[model samples]
Target chain A: MNGYAGKILRINLSDHTYKTEELDKDKALKYIGGRGLGSRIMAEEVPPTVDAFDPENKVIIATGPLTGTPTPAGGRYMVVTKSPLTGTIASSNSGGFWGSELKFAGYDLLILEGKSPKPVNIFIEDDKITFKDAAHVWGKIVSETTSILAEEAPDKAKILCIGPGGENLSKISAVMNDINRAAGRSGVGAVVGSKNLKAIVVKGSSKPTIADSEKLKEVVKESRGKLKDNGVTGQGLPTYGTAVLVNIINEGGVFPTNNFQTTYFDKAENISGEHLAENFLIKRESCFACPIACGRYTKADEVEGGGPEYETIWAFGAACGVDDMKSVIKANFWCNEMGLDTISAGVTIAAAMELYQRGKITDADIDDGLSLKWGAGESLVEWVKKMGRRDGLIGDKMAEGSYRMATHFGMPEVAMAVKKQELPAYDPRGIRGQGLQYATSNRGGCHVRGYLISPEILGLPQKLDRFAIDGKAEWVKIFQDLTAFIDSAGLCLFTSFAIDGEGYANLTNAVLGTDFTQEDILEAGDRIWNLERDYNLKAGIDPSQDTLPKRLLKDPIPDGPSKGNVTRLEEMLPKYYEIRGWSEKGIPKAETLEKLGV
Target chain B: MKIKVRLFATLRENRGKELELSLQDKATPEDVIQELEIAKSDVAILLVNGRDGDFSQELRESDVVSIFPPVGGG
Candidate 1:
């Protein structure tokens, strides 16, 4: 049980019953932890045929072996369940002190099943687990819920709570941990809300055991040095935050603007990381055990202490043709408190704006007296709030996510999503491999699933030609596999820029007393990835779903270095399928499955 | 020839955030960096008028030159 809590808390809300099971050492060895373990248990326990909101569908909050340990960027935790949005196995991750606190509470994972007849919240203190009535806090915003819980809970308590968006089962809702950090995307929050679970409070006074603490300390010290030496993790991110990508992505000719109609945002600099640093940033924040501290705490007009990453900036700023950073910051604050996923909520609003502009919808279709203009930050913020509250017909339509929203308006192509999930900030045409990653990602359109932008734009691990499809399939496969391992290992993917696979392997060996090689870690990633895909396939996700939106396929970027370049996804996909050991239909072959032992 | 130059990330740490530079005729982005006293090796990507540009590419009047250090985030 070295580097593990050696317990799994399983709660069944159907009968108000709970049980603790010993951590299965063999299964832990096979799947590693975090995403890997969570996916394995989900596939085995929950059938794909079950609806995401079904009482049988389980939501698992899992921590990895390195979680709460001294490893750099070790604060991450994952929420895994069948997604209401994509109907696929979803693993949404978040960072703060919660995961570490959960580990300190002496459990590696918590699995919740069934829906309570009344709203309830779970509290964990050391070995004690209590279920309290959540009626008073059920309708509150995320931060408000946590504050209310603090009146009775200990001062050291950390909370993961759902706001009104999740309580109402909005498809774009997110689970907020530590008031701000989100286990965002894939509608994981709605699943929690469906079970009448308002929040999970954790307090622990003990640390998990580690096998080789001295070696772990030494390895972490060395890796921490590497993170400090690297330019991105060391200085740029800590100073400007992830929003720094505004100017860089725009300059690289890949910053998606106006709902992916173009690759450039003319006023990108106005909302750039430099702009945030110069005008809004009051201070920078860091997650537990993280050295980079890329979190931004800033003020936009009257709203202070709202921090936004790059994706939030794009989703609220340039993606909708809004150039006002203050409004974007204000919108971001609302999304966080209301437990909304900024990417899906903002991008859905962007699609709505496009429909409005194209004469597809008019004032009659929208709120009376509210003009849904491209740069109407005020209206955009209003729509986000409405969507969170599911206020009216318009808000109800928006709660269905971008895909269903566009379909209701008779324009599914403008959704800019894959498998019903909205795309993140990076447009595929500019970053060629990113398109493939978005289409083929297990949890739907996501950048972290496989961030090729690292090599294509940031020049990490050596720069590649952005325009070329050559070596891109190989590159995508490599990045996807690497990212899968990083996500599973409970380390932030940012660590990949400084510490390579070898560094991670060494760190894992020192902490967990495992002798896994770099190749072993990568193979584990491939295995976990295939497991998630297999679950999605069983859930009826068509292999054909592994493709990009037509906008990226048919329309050439109007102007940029990527101009005239449509994503050569077809040219690269077959090669990627070949490399991934999947058939033409994107299913894992028997040999591949046998090799991975999944 | 004169162009507005914007520095980003680590490059901005060494010098000012932005500058409007006056360069000799046929001066490349490399010449602009040299004028700023920045080592050519420090720049990872350079953009002229918001498109990818080479250090050796000749600059023109009113061109917008943007330079950045290596940065990675998602």
Candidate 2:
């Protein structure tokens, strides 16, 4: 347990009781902690079909062995629970100082179970834990909640909390940490809201012991050097942040615009990363032990805060047809303040706009002074506020997410989502492997599950013809498996821009004292993937849900370089299933599960 | 042939955003980059009319050639 805190902290909200248990060493070795270990615990302890908001539904907040260690960009944690959004197992990740602080507090995982009768907050200091009444801050925004909680906690305590978005149980609500960083997907914050828990403040005095400090020192130096030398991580990211992808994606003509109706935006330059850096960037931010400062803090008018990442920009700017960078920045700020996932919130608004465009939603259906017209930048911030609070009629329905809202309007097809959760910036029609990855992501339409965009578009590790269908299934499987490992190992996915599978293994080996080969590391990733897939299968996420929207699969892009192209998902899915050792129906074969021991 | 060349990220610094480069017929993206005075290594991704562009492939009239430095994000 050299790299682990070696304890599990379980808090029973119903009875206001807590306990500590030993970490399961065997499970840790197989799952590699964080998302992997959290998913295993969810499947074993919680029924797959349980309602996400049920008192019995549990949330497992976990950190990997690499977390809190002297490893490059090893400051990440996973919030694993059944998603209110997709009904599939959701493991949302965030980077900041909280995960590492939890390790220093002597716990590898925190299991929160049952419902509290009243709003409450949990405070932890090293070995001490207390549950304090949080009725005073129950409906507050994220920054306000953090500041209020910080007043009573120890000096330098890190706070993780929900906002009005979660309090109202918005399906797209996010868990905000370190004020601006978010575990922003799959409605995880709603689970916390259901438990009547408002926030958790933690301060730890010690760090996890590294098995081989000397080896870790060497590994750290090498990885940092690699990250520094890499182009995307070293230069592009630090200089322009993740927002740099705007112009690149737009130039490729795969940047989703107008709710995916078109593949390119004529106004892309007005919202490009270069535009943001030149106009509004206040500073660059970095996570613990991260060399690539890809985070951005910006100001617009009177608002100033973190983010408006590439996806956020696309969702609010191009997807909604709004090219005003200032409005997009403000929307991003409101999203963080309201504790809502920017991708989900912005895309949900885009879906509403589509509904309006088709006459499904008329002016009579909207509140006064609100317009659903495309590129309505002035009303974007107001819509975000309503969505977070579930205010008025449209806000209440939108809080349920685009899938439900669109279906209510008798056109679920209008939602640009896979498995109920909205897709991110990249339209999959032009990027074949990315399409397959989106269709098969465990937690729904998530880009990070398997960012095929790297090899497909960025020319990293060599580029592929973005429209090619051959061998894409293999690439999808490998990227998905590797991503699962990185998410579980508590490292930033951005590190993969420089570090390969073998490099990841070396870093883990130094800290954990385990000599795992590159293949072994991949196998571990494959195991994690299967475990999530199995849980989703049992949770009623059918193989049929493993497909993109009809629009993306059938409708050709009307313009841009990707025009005349559609996602050849049908041509690649069966092959993907074969490569994954799943049946034609997308069920994992018995032998395949046995091989991975899932 | 009149090829529209778009520069992005750091590549746009002194080069400006979009430029109309008048070149001889049969010129490729390589010629376009050379005209812009950008190093080949600086061009991590190049697109012609929204598709992956080959440096030596012949360009067409009204082709939109977009060039980017090493840039990425999800």
Candidate 3:
């Protein structure tokens, strides 16, 4: 139990009872931890087809072996559950002090089962646990809820909670922690809300035991040196934060604009990171144990808070056809306050704008007096508040996400989503490998699942022809499998800029005192990937769902540097299936499952 | 020939955001950066006419050249 807390806390809300179970060491090694362990537990305990909001559905909050340790950027955790948004197995990752605090509380995992008859908050100090009434903070916004809970809990305790978006059961809601950091995808927050649980406050006084302290110290120093020497992790992120990518992506002509109808924004400079640093950025922030410090704290008019990350900026800025940086900052602040996924909320608004443009949504249909016109900054800010509150007819529909909202307007094709989950900032038409990654991502339309953008756009490892089809399937498989490893190990994906498979193996070996080679690390990743894929398949997410939006596949980008390009997914799907050791129909082969023992 | 040159991130500190450069016929992106007094190692991403470009690639009149220092994030 060198790298683990050696215990699992299972809480049954209906009975207001809890049990501490011994950790299974073998399973922890096999699945790594965090997302992998949580997903494995869900696969065994929760039925694949169970409704996401049903009392039977379980929420697993898990931390990896490296979590709360001295490893660089080790403060991370995963929230795994059935997704109400995509109806696929969902595992969302987040960073802050919360994961480390949970580890110190003497549990590797916290499993919430059954529904509470009333709103409640769970508090843990060391091994002590208590359940308290949460009537005062049940429907509050995230910052307010955190403030109230912090006052009631032990001093310096970390709190995780949902906001109005989750309380109203918005399918695009996020679980916010440390006030701003979020496990922000696949509607995991709504699952938390469904149980009538308001928050979890934890404070602890111990550290995770390490097997080889000397080895860990050397590896940590080496890793930290690599991060310091690397141009990206060392300087760029520290200086500009993630918002630096805004101008780079826009210049690449793959910055999605107006909900992907166009590939470029003419006034991108207005919303660029360079401009943010010059005008609105108040400070650079960092999560626990992070050296890159890519988090940004910005202020616009009156609001000040953490982030408007590149994706958030693109979502509310160019994608919605609004170039006002101040409005984008305000929208991001509201997203954190309301516990909404900024990407989904903003893209859903963009889809609604398209619906309005096509006359599917008339002014009469929107009684809230907010215009659906592109670049309507005031409307963007107000609609986010309404979507979080689920106010009015349009707000209620938008709360369900873009695909459902567009389908309600009789045109699901306009949503710009894959598997009913909204796509991120990049337009896949221009980046072929990313297109395949989006289509095949187990969690649906998420960039962090694979992040082909590193090699394809940022040229981290090597640059490939973004439009080329040759060997892209192979690249996708490698990136996806490696990403799975990083997520399970509780490391930030940005660390991949400096660390490779061998480096990850070294870190794991040093932490757990296990002699795992690079090949073993990747094999573990492959196993995790296939397990999630198998779970989704069993849950009725068919192989046909492995596809991009129809617009990306057929219609070419109308204008931009990447104009006249479309995702050639057809040419790569079979190759990807072949590379994954799956059948032609995209089903995992029996041999593959046996080989990985998934 | 005249080319539009764009600088971003740290590269834009002393230099401006954008500039118009005049070069001899058959000037390449290398020449454009040289005209701007930018070190070759300082440029991590180079784009000519919105496509990935090499330092030695010949530039055409009215082509746009974009340059950035080592920077990345999703």
Candidate 4:
């Protein structure tokens, strides 16, 4: 039982049949767990040519060896599948109690397959499993669905469900858990909807057993102390949540505002972390044994959900040109309740706002008789609600995401995205390495897959000039590999800022008895990255698709520290290709593949 | 010239507020800290014109320099 539940739960929705399979030690060791395991399973079981919404499409939810353990910030889980939005391999990891609960439920992984004829909800209680009719809960919002399920099940049950946005098959849907945490990005919720699965509720009292309990506890204590003493984790994140990045990124001239037309927001101060804390923060919440407690509990009259994080704040506040804290908080709450990705929703709405400003979209398109304008908080909130409900033409187009919306309006270049997924807070043009990560990311323009921002923006490990492109290619590849290890380990990426690869390796080695060295951990990360890249390549994505939008390439930062600068992707791309042991066309070399045993 | 500077996050929250700093003529970052009543251990990054500045980097007159504590980041 050490490091795993030693069982896999398989649920077939079409026949309403459920079964349990033994966990393979070989697969677990090779992939580690979480996103790495999900990627491997999806790549092998589901064909590359299969459509993301097809009946054969499978969704894999996995937790790592450390999940449900006492390791600090170890309560993360990953949802992996072919994404309806990006049309690529998608793996979105989320922080919540659900992963821990799932592990405690006597399953290391949950695999869902086949489409159901009708809606259904799955419940797991340790070794017991039940599939019940979810006809009444199918169309409910995330909050109501979760509340109803929790009431029906045990008090301690953890629920992961979607809302009307997902039921409507909205392209930007997210699966919400713990009422606030979301496995958000690349239409994972739509995949859930495609399977006609309503929700998954789990309750378990089983305790996870570790190989070396004494050694594991020591590592956990040391790691937690490091996180608490670290300046960024101890102070910045806990106090302001991720919203702290607003001011920092703005100063770097990378906080894209007004649909990537501007990098700086004059009114950014009004919607920043400092402002959010000063006005709205009610308390702090933690996931499992996390010491950071970056989750915000806000009590503003207009916003009754988790406070807008940095990405959400940037998406709704700066990108849409609406700097009001109340409006940002309200949008955050509405996105969660409606099961929409706040990052994608905000960027898509911002693109629509730009289209409206340019006379490409008429006022007649908006059902509420609203005039979408830059910095109009009221109009922004109105449109967010309409989009959630899919009310009218504007809502319909907005619900499709920015890439499709841009194509529908005949201005695809203005979408401000990579591979259909909208860009997050950091402007790639300002941070060149992030541009490479976004363009080359398996799931479109995601930051977490390989966050070079740690070095490019914050200078955590070693300070580097944000404006320069020197050694960034090597730096990005290293970060991407290390990040893969963290994601697979089910540990929060935030901890990596303070703890190095050796520290993370020790944590894994202590708990799982894997004897992972720092080099072995990084090599595993590299292998996982290559494996995902291979999957995406097999899915018809090639080197040509691994390119940034024209706007980021051509446009220069208008002001601030990075003024008169554009991303030198031309220089970095070749170097990045070389460092990854890939061909000039970005395909992994045979020797490199053999070395990693991919 | 002398000025009042405030630190933030770990540095400000842990250590007491408001550092009185004295600068030499045509002073840079090195000159300001050398003559100031501030601890070097508490300062991680220097913010001149609200942007990151090197400790050895030069400073100009009327620069609103903010000193931040040695904080880690994501």
Off by over 4 Å in 4: B1-24, B30-38, B62-66, B70-74
Return model 4's CA RMSD, one decimal: 2.4
Any runs in candidate 1 off by more than 4 Å, and if so which? B1-4, B9-22, B49-52, B57-63
Compose the digit string of candidate 3's lDDT tens values, residues A1-598.
Answer: 8878989999999878999999999999999999999999999999999999999999999999989989999999999999999999999999999999999999899999999999999999988999999999988999999999989999999999998999889999998899999999999999999999889999989899998999999998999999988878998889998888888888888999998999889989999989999999989988879999999999998999999899999999999899999999999999988899999999999999999999999999987679989998778878988899999989999999999999999999999888899999998889999999999999999899999988888788888888899999999999988988888988888899988888888889988989998899889889999999999999999999999888999999998899999999999999999989999999999999999999
Which 10-residue span in candidate 4 chain A carries the lowest summed lDDT? A380-389
What CA RMSD would you report for each candidate? 1.6, 0.9, 0.8, 2.4
Candidate 4 TM-score restricted to chain A = 0.98
- Worst 10-residue lDDT window, candidate 3 chain A: A376-385
True contacts kept of each: 0.54, 0.80, 0.71, 0.22
Q: How close is candidate 1 at the interface, in terms of C-alpha RMSD after superposing the true interface residues?
A: 2.0
- TM-score for the B chain of model 2: 0.96
What tens-digit string does per-residue lDDT give for candidate 1 at A67-184?
9899999878899999999999999999999999999999899999999999998999988989999999988988789899988797879999999999999988998999999988
Model 4 gets an lDDT of 0.83
lDDT (0-100) at residue A318 of candidate 3?
94
TM-score of each: 0.97, 0.99, 0.99, 0.95
lDDT of 4 by residue, A1-598 (tens): 5878888899899998989999888878888999898888998899977898898999999998888889889999999999889888888888889999999998889999999899999999988888889998988888899989988897889999987777777888898888889888998988899899989999988877889989998998899889888867887788778886776777666889998888888788788776777789889888987999888888668558775788998899899998888888888888998889999999998999898888888777766567678887767666766676677888888878999988898788889888899989988877888888887787888898787887776667877666678888888888889999899988898898778988998899888888888999899999999998888889888778887889888888777656776777887888888989999999999899889978
Model 2: per-residue lDDT, tens digit, A328-425?
Answer: 99999999999999999999999999999999998988985988999999989999999999998899989999999999998899999989999999
**lDDT for position A65 in model 4:** 82
